[model samples]
Target: MRIARLDTPAGPRHAVALGDRWHVIASPFAAPLVYTGDSIPADEAVLLASVDPRVVVGIGHNQPGHPLPMQAWHKSVHSVAGSGDDIYAVRDVGTVNIEGELAVVIGTSATNLTLENAFEAVLGYTVANDVTNVDQCPIDQRNFQGKSGKNYTPLGPWIETELADPENVATEVVINGAVVANSGSFNLPSSVAATLVYVTKWLTLEPGDVVLTGAPGTDLPVQPGDTVDITLAGIGTLSNTIA
Candidate 1:
């Protein structure tokens, strides 16, 4: 099942994709999914960001390169934008980079969630493009400077509630109509389950919080007016224009 956040007359509403249509839900933020009985034509309902994550957690360099999840940081939740939205450049730091990542949506709050049950906290999966300002600062504060810029991450289309194989999901990044990166979510230095369990041991992962499972492949360069699309095989595409 795929869930989405839609733009309604009332406001942004949570919904579920049902074939060619979508039905409003009470709150996907709650588990097992609940519908509000209101429905609409899926194509007509404008899409917003799939999930409004409370906090965006990034696990940097967690792949097979350096030992441990080398670099971790917090991206401002305001950085979250939807597909079709514009990613503006920070005036002084004009360079931009795009990365494709698998985003995990947290469903339930947990503390010290054991590995044996870590997957239980996951609500679904989605695609994320970690947009970075490459005109970075010095080594010590670079990740902070480069990643914390406004509208620096674009996530969207929809959240896939039924991900068949979370471990080996494929990801792709296309810039200005060119495929610049291709990789899978498998065999990472740190697995999703492991990351979930580890992070929750200290932080309480409440519903709607998001954990970006790191970006894969090379970070491709993009410029103002360039279109960058990040797609996770089953989740759908997140496309944004650099402005």
Candidate 2:
């Protein structure tokens, strides 16, 4: 099922997609998927980030030929932004790169999980734009400053809870109406389950936490007034503009 969070006047609300409408539902992490019998037209609903992640984890430099299969980093929770929001450039860094990627949302707390059960902790999958400023510092430093900035990560449109074959999903990045990078899960060096296992060995991910699976292809830089669209097939597109 496709799930989304809406920005209602009352506050943020969880919703489920049914036909062409978004039916309000209870929190997916709290109780069963029960509809609240309230809904809005899918095209009319205002969206928020698919989940309110407390911790945003990133798997960087996981593309083929990287010495380390998994290079992890942390993005501040404040970096999270929803689709249709404007992302401003950090004043300290002149160059900002956009990395379109598939993000995993944690449904349950996970620690030292094995590959067999890694997916059990996953709530769903969503699209992510892992914004970065490589100029902030050397990548070897695991530059928290480089990766973590306000409104840096743009996630959503919605989450896909019923992904059958994640490895076969396609990911694309479009900048200013041009397709710059085209990739897919099949190009990933490690499976999502394996990345989870590797990460859980060191850190425990709690509910509502997010894991960015890593970006593919070369980094694409953006300036103010540039529009970016990242799409993960079977999920949906996440569009944002640089301000």
Candidate 3:
């Protein structure tokens, strides 16, 4: 099932996708989603971020040539935005880049989890656009810019409840309607489940927490007029304008 948060005439609501329509639900963060019986045409309802994670944990070093082991960091919740939102770059920064990644949403609170059972805490997966602002010229190691600002992290379209093979999911990064990066979750050295286990060992991940699985490769920089679309199989596309 594809679960989403939507803007409706009645107000914002949690919904489930069926066919081309979305059925309203009670709670998106809750397991065994309860339907509210109200329905909306898929195109009519405004799509919001798939999950309003209280905290977004970004993992680095999943890509190659990183000197350190895999690392995780906390991003301001204010950085979260829906697919249609604009990602504003810090003024005078003169640098903004994008990373199209697979985001793992936590369904249940978990801590000290082992690899054998970490997947259970995962609610589902969604597309994440890890937008960043390069500090300045002469950028080198230790300059991770996850703190770029609001609109940095765009997540949504919806969440897919089940993924049979996390590693095999295909991902594409599209800039201005062109496919610039083609990759897969398998590019990461470790499996998604293993990454979850590794993260949980250090911090308690609450329900609605998000874990970015890292980008497939070094992506091109985006400008104000450009639209970046991050697409993941099973999960829908997350599109955002750079403004």
Candidate 4:
């Protein structure tokens, strides 16, 4: 099932994809989603970020030549934006790069988890653009200033509740009309379950929390006018403009 947060005439609403319509739901975090029977045409509803994450955890060093250990960082929750939002460039930060990554959304509180059961806490999967500005702070070091810029993380289209093999999911990044990166979750040096276990070892992930599985070898600097489209097979595309 594809779950989405949409802008309805009443306000923001949680919805489940039902054919050509968005069936209103009580909440995406609700166990056995409760449908409200109210629906809007899929083409008419505006999409919001898959979830309003309270904490956004980012993983680094999952790429080669970085390190064997997983490097994690905290980003401001306010940085989250919907698919059609603009990723504003911090003038002082100089160059801004876009890294398309597979994002894991937490459905339940998790702590001291093991790889064997790490997925139990997952709500679903969404696409995230881990926008970076290296000029604000180095990627290898603490990135409080670098990773927390307003509206830097663009996530959505919707969340896919089922994924047979997340690691095998293919990802592609396109800028303007040209394809810039062709990669997949399979390229990550570490698996999703292992990364979740690593994170839950210390930090407790709560519902609406987001974990950004690192984007490898696909980050590219963008200009103000560039439009980026990131697509993960089985999941939908997340597109945003650089401004």
Candidate 5:
């Protein structure tokens, strides 16, 4: 089932998309209930980030071309941004930037999970815009600090449970109507299973936690008023406006 969070007249509510309309799942945006009948067309609804995870983990340099030591993964951290929020261009910082990537949601508690059992931990998949401010530090440090700007991580459109091989899907980013970053999951240096294993070794992943697989190529910079479209192969697209 495809699940999403949306701003409704009542308030923020969880919903499931079916055909051209959405079924209210949960109410009050906290714990939702599935509402059947009376569908609302997807286009008319204001889609919000699928969830506000307690922890929003990110992978650094996980792509093939930017391979780094596993220990360097400490630089990876949790980041968050609201849907349709403005991402600032840190002028004081040297070169602020943004990257688009595919994000995975944990369905169950994962502790020291093995590759064989990793899929069970996965709840669904979504699109993410991992915005960074790269100008102030060295290339290595850039991945650490610049990547975790407040309200810099935008995720959702919705979560899809039936993503054909979530670990090996295609992801792309469009800026102002132009494709900027495009790559296949095959380009990743570490498999999703490996990442889960490595991450769970230090942190216990909860049901709502999210992990953004690293971007594949050079970063893109967005100024105020620019729209970023992040798309995943099986999952839907997440569009956010930069301010």
Candidate 6:
């Protein structure tokens, strides 16, 4: 089911999109009457970020060609952006770039997990725009610095629970309706399960924690007022306007 958090006349509510209408679930934003049969006009609702995560962890160069040393694999990497924050082009220093990547939401707490059992720990999936400032540091340190910028990460649209095989999902990024970066689960160097296990080895993944699965080869610069669309097949699209 495609779940979304939208602004309702009553308040912000969690909803499950069923065809042309929406079914209101538990109100994470506000307490309201549970409307199991009530339907809201899709066009009138404002969609908000899907999950309010406690921590947003990012994986650097996890792709095949961008491999890092084994010693650096366990390092905690992240971008400065938090949920509901706007990403800015000015903070990127000089080389302002955006990376479209698949994000994984941990449903439950996991510690010292194995690849085979990693799937069970996942709550769902979402798309994330991993905004980076390429010119902030040297080529070797760019990934570390670029990821730490304020409001560098934007995620949401909603979490998808039906995607059992995240390793095979297709992801793409579009800039103002133009396809800029395109890749699939098949292109990833390590399996989603393996990456999850590797990540959990260092830190315990708590509920609602997010893991950005690294972007494809094509990395481009973005500016203010630009719309970035990050899409994951079977999940949903995450679009944000840079300010």
Which model scores highest in TM-score? 4
Please give each candidate's TM-score.
Answer: 0.92, 0.93, 0.91, 0.95, 0.84, 0.80
Supply the TM-score for candidate 3: 0.91
Ranking by TM-score: 4, 2, 1, 3, 5, 6
Task: Quantify all predictions' global Cα lDDT against the true fold.
Answer: 0.81, 0.86, 0.82, 0.88, 0.72, 0.70
Model 3 worst lDDT run, 10 consecutive residues:
137-146
lDDT of 1: 0.81
Steric clash count of candidate 5: 7
Query: Please, what are the lDDT tens digits per residue for candidate 4 over residues 1-243?
Result: 899989887888889998999999998888888888899998888999988889999998545576467888888888999999998877766778899999999999999889888889999999999998877655537877777777899989898989887778899999998999999988888888888998999899999899999986668889998999999999999999998
**Candidates 2 and 3 compared by TM-score, better number:** 2
lDDT of 3: 0.82
Better of 1 and 6 by TM-score: 1
Tell me how far the alpha carbon of residue 115 in candidate 4 is from the true structure, in angstroms, after superposition. Answer: 1.4
RMSD of each: 2.0, 1.9, 2.4, 1.7, 3.7, 4.5
lDDT tens digits, residue span 1-243, model 6: 666777677776778777787777764323343555656777676776666667777665443455463222221233433334567665526868877777887877898889779988887787777777777648645256556655567767776878857888887888889998778766766667777887888889887788877665535788887788777888877777777
What digit string (tens of lDDT, one per residue) describes model 5 on residues 1-243? 788877788777767887888888643223334474445688898877787688777786533555564432322234565557666655666666777777778887888988888878888877777787766447655356676666578888888878888667887878899998788666777777777887887888888788777776625877878888878888877777876
Listed per model in order, the count of residue pairs whose N, CA or C atoms clash below 3 Å is 0, 0, 0, 0, 7, 4
Q: Model 3: runs farther than 4 Å from truth?
A: 62-67, 136-146
Worst 10 residues of 4 by lDDT: 60-69
- Could you give me the TM-score of model 6 versus the true structure? 0.80
Whichever of 3 and 6 has more lDDT, that candidate is: 3
